[model samples]
Target: MPPKLSPSGALRFETEEHTLCGLCRTPYKSCECKGLKDNLHDWYVWHGVPSTMIPSAKDRIFVGLPPPPDNSSRTKLVKRWVSLVNISMIMGHFDANHWFSTKWESLNASMDARTKLLNEMVADYVAQLPTNTELTVLARVLGLQRRAIAGKVDGIAKEAWAALRIFLSGDWACMSKAGSKLLMNAFNTRDPKKYPRDDPHLERILDSGVSRIYGVMEMGFDKKGYCLAMEPGRRPCGVGTSTTLETSDERLISKKARKRKTTKESIPTKKRRRVES
Candidate 1:
């Protein structure tokens, strides 16, 4: 038969050696058991936990009280998580172009006039660019340009408008200080005399160059036409003899003749019939 267990809660053990204090595992009150218990009691006291298992009304009330409100760190973490989820959902709809056409159309209909204006500015900026630029260059340029523009505008509202335009444009390219400074200065000044009136034209040039740079950057294309940017040495200039001959009339005829012979072998001749309905 199994040995009868001790009646003490959480203290029952199978062996005599294990019959020591459940908490300290030392001989009950004798050894360091009492010291350990006193230390635990002091800890509970410091932490505001009741020393006794049974509670007074005050103890009960304290125990029943909810925890204090979350601190800013906790709140910030929660917000970050929510933001990440929202961003992931948004990213699901966008393509390589960084646009969700359907979402954009719906938004365009509902958005305010300021929002519409910002979107148009971005669209026009992107439209001004040719398809050949590197993407990295475009991203950097766009960010720099936007910052410059925002710095010029005094009000937070105007800066926000400028920022929205940059985001929508999807132009990320590295730009020189000269170009960036020029844009920043122009954006901040409202006076016609201080700033050039030809903003639309200037904006177009900036936007297109930025977009092309971004595309090239993304493709890892060098300043030269070579695919890899880091590689040195000039790429061959003209079409090679092998490439030209491959597209010549003789090559085309031979390919066509081979296809025809293959098709003839695959199919059987059939008798022609008169159409009498």
Candidate 2:
């Protein structure tokens, strides 16, 4: 089937053929075949997403699910979620062993290492903020404000705040939820100072070691495996299942199929006669 063309005129195809022009198979434009031939130099260049679809600064901050990942978009919602969760865990003092003891002590060590790495990342972000910018300006103007203004932020902020209140009320049972929220809020906030000094943000800093541990755990396992560990029989382990396949069984199946196909094709056809041999 002919590949669909994106609004920008870039052909989008599921197969590799789209990499070449539709009219001609050649990578270069010299093989022109009408509509596919113009300015081939610029053809290879990808036209990114339209600016109208792009989320403004005001779009990211206040509250809602982030937009889908796109080539034109600078931030990835999943990566941001992962980073925020890890940071919150670290600041909350969650134990690495609790999540990864089944894996290895070394895994726990690696988790600590990752948390430190994320801390450095947060530090870099914090450092980049202009010292001259007022704390209030920084707080109100952060990514959250942009998202809030743009109407792209999720309703999760209210839930997060509710969880935070529970944590502040001295309920350790709500710690996990609160920590998660703190991380989410941090990513959403333009000003880090808005994160409560005594609890929310401080918890993230304090639990940095643990967050690193969790980050390592997350990185060590694929999504399926991680889900399996979390939900057990409800989800299968992605890595464990892939590794369990027997090569001998696979080879036997392939051999039998090939033999059957060859036997079927070997059924003879009548030969043609030569009159003047």
Candidate 3:
């Protein structure tokens, strides 16, 4: 059976021990983080998931991130297609490993502005897929970039460079027999800005996601237990929860404040007795 994503924050998921944590990702994407164990106290070590505080991939198909709990202040913004189009659109903060500085303000002010652009790109890619199965897209993504035993390819325009960048730098190797470094290298070099507008890699990952890219499906987060799910035999523990959201922001602020306060404190003058020697 598929997972149930509750809008009230009461949800249950079922997947085998070795399977993906089944959140914020497609078969083509990778979960580089850990998930919450059923216990809710200790972290889930095996198949982990990304943080829910940010957007997550949910709904058997598309929708940006997880839909908010019943009482979230951000409710007005739920289900917005652009919310999850970029994969890292979770929490509205651009993850550095994916997007560098200065791209934060690139969100479309109005949906109308992005509709045509996204549609054109997606239609192009969807037409070429021989089989719409998850494995097919995964195969393409892997073939387009790197292979575990064989290593990497030169360019990244074939994988969702325009519509999405699914494979996380750390997680892409989950399906490969080689080290994940190859995946990371391919992802890092796939910056859309680096490629020209004519590049064909920028296309939708799955044909089924058109409605999602167009804001038609439900979305949802949480399940840090994704690392091991990607690779059955790998040692994927301690894939800790993402503290990258507000907690991290607060810590950074507090650190700066402490530094300022310390500087403001007057330094006592050394006693003249030292000169008597």
Model 1 earns a TM-score of 0.15
lDDT of 3 by residue, 144-247 (tens): 22343222221222223321221211111111211122222232333356433343322221111222222221111222221111222221111121211111
The global C-alpha lDDT for each of the candidates, from Candidate 1 onward, is 0.26, 0.28, 0.26
- C-alpha lDDT (0 to 100) for residue 122 of candidate 1: 40
On lDDT, the candidate that comes out on top is 2
Per residue, candidate 2 scores C-alpha lDDT tens digits across 1-277 of: 5544333312223332212221112221122333212222232234453433321111001011222222311112222323322332112233333433343334334433344443443444344334423333322322233434223123223323322332222111112222333333344443445434454334443354334423433432222111111101111112222233222112112355435523432332222112212
User: Please, what are the lDDT tens digits per residue for candidate 1 over residues 108-179?
Assistant: 232332334434444443333333143234333323224343332222223223233222331111111222
* Window of ten residues with lowest summed lDDT in model 1: 56-65
TM-score each candidate: 0.15, 0.20, 0.23
lDDT for model 1 comes to: 0.26
lDDT for residue 114 in candidate 2, whole number 0-100:
44
Worst lDDT 10-window in candidate 2: 55-64
